[model samples]
Target: HDVTADDVRLAHREGYVSVEHLKRYTTLGMATDQGKMGNIIGIALMAEALGREIPEVGTTTFRPPYTPVSIGALRGRSVGSHFRPLRRTPLHDWNLVQGGTMTEAGLWQRPWYFAQNGESLAEAYVRETATTRRSVGLCDVTSLGKIAVQGPDATVFLNRVYSNAFAKLPIGKARYGIMLRDDGIVMDDGTTWRLSETDYFMTTTTAHAAPVMAWLEELLQTRWPDLKVHVTSVSEQWAGIAVAGPRSREVLEAVVSDPTIVSNEAFPFMGVIETHLTGEIPCRIARISFSGELAYEIYVASDYGPAAMDLVWGIARPMDGCLYGLEALGAMRIEKGHVTAAELDGRVTIEDAGLGRMASTKKSYIGSTLRQRPELMREDRPRLVGVFPEDRGETFNAGSILCAADNVAGLGEGWITGVTHSPELGHWIGLGFIAGGHGAWYGKTVIAADPVRKGNVAVEIVSPHMIDPDGERLHG
Candidate 1:
């Protein structure tokens, strides 16, 4: 009677040798998707209650390719633009016209700024840096990963996948969230835009969008298959650009009519809205600036993304839009204490990323078990933090190991994941993960652990938030 008596009788007559055999014959839990939506224990309980053997009820052996496609095969033949769906700017044709060289700055292809009489790559970057600080600068950010997740369970799906809670995020608002591995290690961080009560868009570092989306789906389908949710990547459908600097607003306002649609009051910092910029042009814009300055990121459909970018450049050239590049963005991010993918890679945990609070330990979730281990909670772990050379003039190439060696100067220091000569700070700044770098390790010096130039590099412990000490820039 405990066994679904009606179902059991059906199985008996359906040629299933037994209840266990019935499961095998039905191929229950026998698919690559892993019967993520099926009944496993319930059937098992049915057999036990009926005094039947498990083998008589055989298990569903979910086949291989058990999870998702192999990263190598999924990546397949495509590299660069071809591999990931990228927005070729509407003015991409103009790049050929201007004889400009282009490269990836996230998922989008951005002009590395026009080459002058004879400008080399280094010269171009340096010039671009100065232009933005002194004038204005523009960047194509179309490649930042974007995904639209919809369905009634969308909110629940997002909350489970991210370390932070998302169920309470109000519609028409956005929140910055971090995703973590089952072990409480940070996997990725991104902005979640609640387009409506049931529809949402997520943007992640260009490198992790595809993987993160897949991770979310697998968890939902397998872990909570009953939840109603669908996630789709739309990174290619829209072209996005960042126009930054003190004159950024001026340049944007100059190109558009009825500036009120994209106004500072309506599209304020971290605000999300579906609206147009440039009265005649009609481009969707978000007042999100990653340059650590007042900036606007304009989004337009793929067909117009390029043209919008060109028009922006025309407006920016007069205002001195900085021909900014990846190097400069990397530097500004490090200076702002923003630990991106480089610092938050698989080796680091949420706690190490200074976002230990991001994870929810009070509730049941994946990776909640191993996260409680003493080793994981210890302070001696290779904690993520900020570091710089004590001697300003000397340079320490990144990835230099930090050592307190006795006879090492100008030698290898701690390994650097990212380093930059900051115009804002007047000294080279860097960010990286340092083993045993927190707690009593504060203020203590270390030597670069690299074998090639052992003990030459010198560094001191510092908090990761070197700039925007109190997040004044983000708030303002």
Candidate 2:
């Protein structure tokens, strides 16, 4: 039966004032189909009853699924075979053959780990991490966001967007840059490689690919219309593989046409090279490391990705190389005290994240003025630091509140954001924030109270760099 006009009047008289409240109270549009037919009628009735025009009364905001449709229609031809709309890397099929434990990251289906028979998920990830630290390991990093910036004003455009200086960066060099929000919080961190005098390749975190592209477009089209800069997203056009560890050069030398291209003397760390593999497969390589170890990220065209992946695997197998996944990737970053979206979450300022020095003073960039607000530079702000369980065997939960050991009754000093067990350090380490930074609590013991998980642990505050404080391993 249709909803009668009286239902609307009764709902109003009962004090269900707001349109949303009235709708829910009367169950006016709560049908399985969300009342595609009855919504307008109900709105009209309410407006009439309220002695106001329809616009004055207003209607519920229309959302998705405009009209009722079957799931079958949405699925269309992409039934079981392609239901997930997954973006697979070139070695996706080969990873399956190697017993990869697949996981979804954004729209891409990435391997979480390559588990061996009789190995649990944790064991597999730990083993992969240990192997990479000891020898060589490769990870498919194709999901990273890529953008091609070409034009005479490309340098100027980048200089305006990033906090660090990039206009003077020479060709064949890569610089790590961090972009901040208009309100001074970090937006994203990535490496921008200077391909030539007028062109550069920018890489962003995978989750920010689309938004960052939109940001650049807005800046160019709305703000700097006359700037000779053209930006295009090329994440799909390029496939990336990060070769990390001490023996990375050895494995890369075998697959690349010129072994000298990757030599330390010719291609120093943070160097970029445009070249081809032995089979004439075109590629671009950047010497960068996320794992605190010597590493190189190799990028090839989409069509040649599969063959390149296979070739690298073939060469790496004989050279004691292993395939690792996201679990190991995260742990390695934690050990190195690096921050991703997890630590740079939109609310914190650059100084709070321990990246204040990266923001330049001599030159202007986005968020430069806003970042200097006196309130943001307070010494008591929650600053990034490493915490370790006192017992070494105990572990605290992520999101656990931190408090002074003697003042457990207080609100909180800060909270743990990330946790990981370091295979190299042989203990559980964490990245967290505290109100009074290094100067205040440099070696003091604090309590990590995890109310949600019903647990607590005594932790020692230390510098975020839990391993290789001098970065000797990374430079190796």
Candidate 3:
């Protein structure tokens, strides 16, 4: 290929003046030699075109292995399954002993479902979901990213990072919060529990755990150095298990040293308590429910995790409770229309995820101004909604394109992000995003067109809160 300064000048004339943009616009640094010969010439040309010194137009960032390296050099030992490390929770072996089928969640091998008496995946999860709703269920939640934010200015730090108000979050309580990227897209959503006046515990999704921690550190170190705050990852320090269901309180009452503290009046929903489990094992319990059931998440030191699981399982098992896993967890969240990684994908805005109300109007936070960009606030943008197969027994997969019943071609209105058999509704259900949201399509039939899979099914658009719209079970 011929190299020329004319190409750089053309890119600059086209408004791709930044070195990064110039390189991309004109392929300045993408030669076989990796720009060693022509990148400088291109920069000088770009700078000349703008009538600026060469230093004024900064150089493009260089990526390493300056010279090309062989594939064998990069793959010294790690390859195939060993390429990435695997993480196991303290209850990993216990789940296997109880017939849990494992699946990957990021680097962690979490139980997908617990099969009993040779039940299929669907049968097992259905049983697990039903049993949990009817009684108690325990799930390993240790993979969630745990960060301990403590300092004199921790409250101020949290209030600015989160889109919602956190300064007024009372001590001994937990509040759901969402953070946004500088570009105004939702970065992550999780719950933060205030342990004391200056101490707070935050949880992030398993896949985002590391990134969220790094993001926080970057903000404190680079953006808000004046703030006196320290954030540390405590994910490995604590092993967490969620005890959920209508009978969740009953199960906790049996395990906690003081039954009174686990009561509805004493503990209350979203309340946090530092208490001891059976045998006086110290633990932190938070009243939170991802399954939309009255539930509590108990956290114990990593070393005490196995013993804590044993104690909780012993009591829950005898009470007809079962151990649920990721599959059931997904089904439950879908039933309640809760958003997860599937919906919080970087492309979505807070409002697109049906969480606009969580964005505080009283105070400005990260992404506050940019989120108001006209393009993001457009009413026609795809927003979260519930999807259901028009035929009771029909099933559709996630990633299926949602189109009007009359038009099943092209990208259509929107797409399904997640799908599952709703044991509660006794049919298949899904959570997806569609233009104009549920209000625009409620009671209307649409085509779930999965062209890649060669299937197209008619589906009804409805509110994301397909079950427990009023959250009766969650507060029961």
Candidate 4:
């Protein structure tokens, strides 16, 4: 607003002797003029107050757009849908051709569900989820964040950033790992494959791709400059497709150049292999499952993505397989109680998300010490658990509050993070966090209270792995 020499003097007396400090304390140079008209006067005043030369007093740094501009000029060419650019995967058009309904994941438009015979959203997803478990299903997972980490120190670097141990990870094997922020809260979780002694490939959730990459760069440049590691984002270089279901291996065996490599004894779960499809297109196959079924994720060059999709679809279709989408993928993961962004929100700790066992105790990692803070170690903190409707016919929405039977108001003890109609369990189920986890609430019922949506259903607490509590189906 209004500034004077007296104000500058007052700021200096208050120990704000620097020009930058004086400017902030006196609200100088922050008005409509942006200091263009008044900054020199303010500087002169500040110099006089300090009884020093104007140059000695120094001046606050100036940012660009030196002259004032109208809002219209600033908004040029950014109106409507053009406001933000959209990123598409290699299979974007192919998914649309297969009758896929698209939804936005970050800036990428991905298939939400592939409708058939005029099926509704619910109908389509249910059918897709069932078909996948019954036979085979192909899903586009190219949106996942792929990063290449190389050099001799890659292994040691990973061991420091990830909560789990990675120093001794065998080549040609992948391990699921979790990362924690400097504050000891969960940041992201993903699978990293040890391609060679000096090379590794990592896949992060789509939403955390860019941030995680930046975090890695910041750490290497500022925190551990001596470590011989180079990290690069390879997300756009490869197109990924997850072939899942009981017959997933059969679909791969039909197209892979060497069928024997797909055998369980040869490429067991969490195994990785660099192979070719149909004796031509180079690809990498990893035996990993997010649907709790026998599955493999095939990665091919971006240019060959369309061809890979066609080849896989041609073989899977005749075997009663279908093309599933994100909706169906969510259903299966929910059935198995897998955690996603909904559960790993920045507020939760590794233990809060039921991944405490994964935190390595042998070696110190990024968050190892901070994660053991007294407040974070409290047992009463919200812990991940499964929520099932007592009536089996009722359903609850994500963000619904879980409370005691008599108290349904306020934030309550916990809240639902995700919900799905589980085709495998033949009922609606949810993955949520409660005050004390399954051990404290098992065999007890809680009210799923959603005041805004007018939903209040009685849901029983149970283990998050509602469908396959054991490893039978995963190892199949």
Candidate 5:
């Protein structure tokens, strides 16, 4: 009564050569439900009958409408605002109540801009940027990757993984480090804080968290099994708020129970301290800045994120500050000439990123040998640079190809990687890569052509550091 192994063998022997053919010849998976539950079993039977592996037997490609449905059923009952699945942060509801224009960041619905009454999106974001530069500003930066690394050989393990030296980094201090792939290209860059001799905390770019953790585990498991190192991702366990600007320390000192913990003498720039705020809220504050300002990032338990954000906002409100959003954050980093994943793009070498010097010559690292290859050290390699539109009003989109006016299309000398309207520069600025970089095209006029976006704009090549070339505000 049931289809036996002999049935499958008989079908294959009778010129039903393919699994798909065998299925159709015998109605093996063509029952009422149409093979969803039976297809794998049918495939295995066909493979065994033919004495071939499942992969060798191939799979049936199912065209759309896998289960036949009415046109109305294709369109679900949920529509309009309910169409897409939305993931929220701890401060999601609070951001909504504050009239934030929530948008998708990764999978999370984060506030893109908090528009006041009648304010345009441009006006709102520009105002946010200017306010952050002039005074204190708070941003929910919990989306960044956090991983706790510990074990007896943790320092040695980190030193092997990152380009910079970390074996002797003093406790309570954090240092920015760059990671490189085996091919000598930048993988990810972030700060690592030494908590103790055997403990360290590492932060990575938001998207690279899981991949970076996996890379570390693979290295330990395969390359160096004797090394005693362990890594655990803690991104979901904590929330991060970046409080940045000239008045950041003032706001921190006002709220932190132990003023000395955040004082200049005790916790200078790049210093990290774990302590509590008012209401005995457990917290860790790091004197780190992404806006090129004197800033500190406060970390707290995930459940307490909204309360921590509220506390910072309350203290910063009287200090002539505001709550900034993602737009402002992007603009500030651009002004600082910082290289984010957008600029790295997985293809650029550490040398091409202008961070080659940070790669240690004193010690061998993961990519050290590969990085010194002749091809990677070529002088004509595309390197990071800043582009300022000749007409300040003109904005260029990313993915535009840069070329000398005479060059043919698609044969670009370089390309724009990111673009933003810089409040500090009072113009549209972009970060990009160019062959024979930096001074190779100094003062030369080039055309940025976006065939896809149907845009072409003339731009002047300039030093990436359009804002503080001397690093004044960042260190002050």
Candidate 6:
């Protein structure tokens, strides 16, 4: 309390890992989530500590979302139809015309399938699964969370909050980061793209966009409130169309970009840049593909959605780029070993998501104390792991019991959180948590039983990363 802001800046220049820590030790940006409040003022003091001018120290950027919006405000009127932004396929209105039912797959609300008379959810899901597997069926992915984080402080805020480093990421480049609770558990995973040295855009789990944005603000405005930053949920301002399959890219090439448009090199994997589509509409295009192929996240003004979907489908139709439903995506991700909200939820830790390397040691942050507890540090803490059935007709339901055999045979070891009948793998596969995750248990056998699924089944424990076993697909 006796020390001045200049003293705090001096301590930081000497080597503080994060501005949040600088706030605690020197009280720099502790002005609520408006970190820049103190940051601007703090930097001035920091300059004084170094005998430099305020201009020499610099200032925060003008990012989007000038202030924090309440979770309630963001939710607004679409409590149900609007609880989330609805995903519509080129034929979505047609499906509604045919009395089809819809549900969410990731952030996209895709039609489960067309029912004849009295088909249950299970029946609908099975039919939808078959339709995509055999032939081509359309699914909507517009609901997938897409956000635009702008301003100079964009990269600055991203680097401090994420467990991974992103300060040096080049423009048009994207990086993956896992959000961690102070105890070093996985909270959320998302992709961030550096649009410019000062501007960054990121996407989080559809369910976590609000909270993650809030968390970012809390850091910039509160703990490290001096940092300049802005975050906006443009999830609805723009829409995303994901057309997957072996032919997705070829079909897309059919809808050629207008002249003066940046080519593939300008927006490669994790590439982020602004461009005009069809030679008119201004859009932000990111070379981000989640379909496990050469894909692009096409962003356009809300007004251009109908045209965008039609143009994309027109291209895909000839190449057999079936709009694989959410079901297929789920199957694809599970087989690829990626973890989603259903599997890792907020209750999970960084260890479970296989991201212990993201934590920063240079400075302390929220939950820093709880993260270091011995119990949490233990290698085996019900880490998120993949499971494969051992015998014939073996599959477990969500929340099914998991028992460790031979290796962690002490008691009921863990439980399955996400289960789906894999069309690709044929055998029922699952993602679940198990105690004693380290050592022999890493490759040991665990029995997963679901009373709802005709009893218990045996599954093998494996790493959470199911796709790109070697990171070939992501980089390629």
lDDT string, candidate 2, 1-476, tens digits: 34577878888788765778877778777765576667778877778777888888777766667677787787677667476577887768877888898888877888899888888878888888888888989899999999999999999999999998997999999999999877787899999999999999999998788889999999999989999999999998998989988888888899899898788889888999999997999999999999888899999998887788889888777776789998888888888888887888787888888888888887888888888888888889999988889999998888888999888765689888888889998998899899977677877889999867857799988888877778776667
Please give, for residues 307-330, the per-residue lDDT of candidate 4 as tens digits.
999999999999999999999999
Task: Show where candidate 5 strays beyond 4 Å.
Answer: 1-87, 452-454
lDDT of 2: 0.86
Superposition error at 323 for model 5 (Å): 1.0
Stretches off by above 4 angstroms in model 2 are: 1-85, 409-411
> What lDDT does candidate 2 reach at residue 367?
88
TM-score of each: 0.74, 0.84, 0.85, 0.86, 0.85, 0.70
Task: Estimate the TM-score for candidate 6.
Answer: 0.70
Model 1 residue 73 distance off true place after TM-score fit, in angstroms: 22
Find the number of clashing residue pairs for candidate 5.
0
- Give each prediction's root-mean-square deviation over alpha carbons: 13.5, 7.4, 9.9, 6.5, 7.4, 17.9
Superposed on all Cα atoms, model 5 deviates from the true structure by an RMSD in Å of 7.4
Q: Of models 2 and 4, which has the larger lDDT?
A: 4
1 or 5, greater by TM-score: 5
- What's the lDDT for residue 471 in model 6? 55
- What would the C-alpha RMSD of candidate 3 be, to one decimal place? 9.9
- Count clashes in each candidate, considering only residues at least 3 apart in sequence or on different chains: 38, 0, 0, 0, 0, 25
The global C-alpha lDDT for each of the candidates, from Candidate 1 onward, is 0.69, 0.86, 0.92, 0.92, 0.85, 0.63
Better of 2 and 3 by TM-score: 3
Q: Which runs in model 3 stand beyond 4 Å of their true positions?
A: 1-74
Model 4 TM-score, 2 decimals:
0.86
In candidate 2, position 54 carries an lDDT of: 80
Tens-digit per-residue lDDT, 1-476, candidate 3: 36677787788778998999988878877876677768988888888899999999999887776697776898776887788898988888888998899999999989999998889999999999999998999999999999999999999999999999998999999999999999999999999999999999999999899999999999999999999999999998999999999888988999999899888888888899998999889999999999999999999999899899999999999899999999999999999999999999999999999999989999989999999999999999999999988898899999999998888888899999999998889999999999999999978889999877859999999999988889887777
Best of the two (1, 4) by lDDT = 4
| Candidate No. with top TM-score | 4
